[model samples]
Target: MKKITFLLVVFLALFSCQKTDSEETNPLLNAVLYMQQSAEYKALTLQIYNNAAIHLERALADKNWTAATEQNGDYQNLPPAVILDVDETVLDNSAYEAQLINSGRSYTSESFAAWCKEARAGIVPGALKFCTAARKKGVTIFYVTNRGNAQKEDTRKNLRRLGFPLEKEIETILPRTDSSDKGKRRAEIAKRFRILLLIGDNAGDCFSGFTHASQVKRDSLVRVYQSHWGSKWIILPNPSYGDWESALFDYNYKLPQSEKLKIKRSRLVE
Candidate 1:
């Protein structure tokens, strides 16, 4: 936890002079933090749960006609499947984050693995009911996550612990093996089922397995899918790290601490 807070402090101090107008305007996060300090993000998470439920119900019922094109360079034709990214969208591991953050601890793969074994995280705002409903509607629920293969047991235990429906008999939770290009896995899954819905926190998670794309490619892909943003692909807010932030720094996770701060600070719009 100390390490997590230290990273946060390092972030805040370096970027303190550059708080973007949008960052200052992020009300939901403000509310979440306030609720956290005052013992409230839990309530907000519950509220999220209700909204998640509502969103899923609406999506399932929306028989409205629209055509979506899958632009994988190789296999152009894809079939029916609703892909869901794990972590903040379906499973709420904020408790794990909270445990680290509140105690000022940083996350270790091993410690997180242990946390998964305990299986105590909450379901994201509306995820449990949403996934269950999709399954009942005969929509195949494919949990395509960036979590590594090594973390499989804990991820699965955490999902079942939180009551997420495991539709696939073997490894309903698919982990990232090579590049974080999630679309590759999505393509593999699409070979079997037509992906109807793509739900996740990160834009890459929804952009068909694009972890390693250049900034231009990422932007182009976003433009390609702009029409389907809130309908076929549902994006929930995640205030912390993602490829968007990484892109700004060229995905250089090995940068010196000060240089890291400088790069992120450069991008902060005041």
Candidate 2:
């Protein structure tokens, strides 16, 4: 009888511990974790929109082609447009990676492409409403992502699912092709857009040649664009991956995993 009672207590303690453990850990954890769990975080989209809207308004009022130009020109309130990076900028696909991590699966283009086709990715905080409001203000919002061009139709569908009201005919979609570098696409975007404001998660998406450049070149390039850092270039937060990570290893995607880790370790200050 005592043994049975002891076992029962042990089982209860184990159950309590398991419940607490589950409460402490989540399979889907990322910047959007709060949004998925809380309504308050979900509404942050509006705040993001408002902040960006204010930036654009201020830029226009100040007449800045480069996010508040010098001397405030007559074109202060001229028609405005924004360039947005797609992956991680407007869509939160980290959940798919989370799903893979939780399931002990590796990332593959085939699997990722399959996941991309789901079109279930939630919007990045504030991206949807910001773009929506910008659209209302007659600002053309264009998405410029490094996603392969094959995913174009699916990407558009995903954006539409999130209520983006895409300018499908306005030529805003800019997915990556075999020939696209970060700058190549930006140059393409430049041809059609004044591109008053630019937004994205990755440095490559935001700065052309930034990812594939030497470290010294990276710093120099950033300095050249330093003036526009926060004003015209509103970078979204992302820790998972970016061109920065690639540049750390000299942009050699063909390097073995062990060599990459060695390179990262050598560069570590600590």
On lDDT, the candidate that comes out on top is 2
Measured on C-alpha atoms, candidate 1 has an lDDT of: 0.65
Candidate 2 lDDT over 1-270, as tens digits, reads: 999999999999999999767544432344335545566654554565566777887765554474322213354444566888887778988788677646655456888889888878878777877788778877887787777877888998999878885774677788877655656666655555456777876656666656577887877988888866667877766555667667788778788756876887798796
Q: The CA-based lDDT of model 2 is what?
A: 0.70
Query: What tens-digit string does per-residue lDDT give for candidate 1 at 1-270?
Result: 999999999999878756664355432344345533543555554565555455555655554321123433322233335678887777766666656554544446788777767777667656777677777876667788888888777788788777778855645688987867687777677555555667787887776435666666778888877866666677766655567656777887777645865876787779
* Top candidate by TM-score: 2
Q: What is the lDDT of residue 88 in candidate 2?
A: 74
Looking at model 2, which ten-residue stretch has the lowest summed lDDT? 67-76
